[model samples]
Target: MMKSILFFLIFSVSAALSAQTLTLTEQQINQHLTTQLGRDFPINLGSWLKAGVRLADIQVALGRQEADKARVSGRAVVILEQGGVRRDWDISGDFSARPRFNSEEGALYLDEFELLGYRLNNQDASGQANFIMPLLLQSLAEYLAQNPVYRLDEQDPLQRQLKESVLGLSISPGQLTLQGLE
Candidate 1:
């Protein structure tokens, strides 16, 4: 009886220690981003541009690059008002950024964003598109900086424990894994 109890205790402790890592799937991350971004759509471009933009159909790819980075692509509608006339342009763009973990906040954030490419509905407006891209990127960067791409649920006992420790973040083919740092 004594031997059986000792073995059981050891087994339970080992199991708990091994389960310290949290993994997030690509679909899960995309869903979270879409919901969070949806709240702040039709972002204004400030007085200097006389324009605004809205993003939709956001998608994310993890571990797509040679380095530790994430790729995000989405469709944007740029609304420009000139002489009281409103014109809307459709644009699609891809962006890449490094993923970082904020232990204090128990969240994952994307940092150091880079625009991979952008396409405009009218090729003739390529020059104008170049000018508008920076503004759109700025808006996105600001939003991401303030918002987390994924957050650990403190309600779960394991996740709550994870929130208190430093974690090492890694990207696999289609998932983000956070492992507790010793």
Candidate 2:
């Protein structure tokens, strides 16, 4: 019994000392997501806007978007206003990006923007969502071209260390795993 206890103690201590893994809970991940994606997407329609579309206040607000396999998915609302009139469009899609060569940041983009519905002149615009979606996506793409969001911590040693040593980051439904990170 004494020998067994000693062996267990040693094993526990050794295991604790050698451990170099960082695990984040779902709540923590959700909080980070909320904070990161909650920011308003400030964008300019550029040439996509017609003459009356000039000075368009185009903004997209993203809700909690889950990140998995280096890809993010979630819901978003696009708002456009001009001449005391406004339009609100809702969409759920995935945001993807490819990391630059040896760069910490990636060029983020909206891979799929599926408009769920919209409101035009304060009326249900669900019927027109299908038709307007293409235009909205076109303008959205233009804005995204200028502004791309990234989730990278180049200056953060912990994150950088994990990313450098880890083989890959796999995000699942409610868990994130770092493969062979340490």
Of the candidates shown, which would achieve the greatest TM-score relative to the real structure? 1
Candidate 1, residues 1-182, lDDT tens digits: the string is: 99999999998788667657878888988988777543434556766556666665678899977458899888767777756867677778788888888989998888887888877866556466677667776676666767788888889887788886754778888898888732
Report the C-alpha lDDT of model 2 over 39-92, residue by residue, as the tens digit.
455445454432112212232333324443233345556675545556675565
Poorly placed runs, candidate 2 (over 4 Å): 1-21, 43-46, 50-73, 81-85, 90-123, 126-128, 134-160, 171-173, 180-182
Q: Backbone clash tally for model 2?
A: 1
The deviation in Å at residue 172 for candidate 2 is 4.5
* Per-residue lDDT value at 72 in model 2: 37
Candidate 2 clashing pairs? 166-181
Window of ten residues with lowest summed lDDT in model 1: 35-44
Per-candidate TM-score against the hidden true structure = 0.77, 0.44
Instruction: Work out how many backbone clashes candidate 1 has.
Output: 0
After superposition, candidate 1 runs with Cα above 4 Å error: 1-19, 41-46, 122-127
The lDDT leader among the candidates is 1
Clashes per model (N, Cα, C within 3 A): 0, 1
